[model samples]
Target: MGRLTDKVAVITGSGSGIGRQIALTYAREGAKIVVADFNEEGMDQTVSQLKEMGAEAI
Candidate 1:
């Protein structure tokens, strides 16, 4: 399992840019992600991408 397995990361501004990258990285490490951003559409997209990668995100 990854080092972050069973961890949960709450990432702000994760709808795009650096925040999104960080969320992706954490997800890769097996963390569940809670994406927070003012951009609802962007957040949805980020969640979709994470789910596609087999990551648990909301």
Candidate 2:
């Protein structure tokens, strides 16, 4: 298991740019992600990508 397994990460501005990248990285490290951003569409896209990686996100 990853070091972040069972951890939950709340990431702001995750709809795009560095925030989004951080979210993805955390998910890869086995953390569940809480995505927050002003851009709804970009947030959804990030969530989708996380799910595709088999990571839990919302």
Candidate 3:
């Protein structure tokens, strides 16, 4: 199991920059991600990547 197994994470401004990185990292740890951001592109990219990594992220 990952470090954050079954955890719920809500990340703001996750469309880019440090926030995005944190969101990705948390998701990789098996946590659910709430991807929020003003940048639609970044948000979509993050969402796609998280899904590819087998994380339940949005």
Alpha carbon lDDT of residue 3, candidate 2? 80
Query: How many residue pairs clash in all the candidates, one count each?
Result: 0, 0, 0
Model 2 TM-score, 2 decimals: 0.98
Q: What is the C-alpha lDDT profile of model 2 across 1-58, one tens digit per residue?
A: 8889999999999999999999999999999999999999999999999999999999
Candidate 1 C-alpha lDDT tens digits along 21-57 = 9999999999999999999999999999999999999
Model 1 misplaced regions, further than 4 Å: none
Q: Estimate each model's TM-score.
A: 0.98, 0.98, 0.90
Q: What lDDT, from 0 to 1, does candidate 2 have? A: 0.98
Give the TM-score comparing model 1 with the true structure, all chains together.
0.98
Q: How accurate is candidate 3 locally (lDDT)?
A: 0.90
Better of 2 and 3 by TM-score: 2
The collision pairs in model 3 are: none
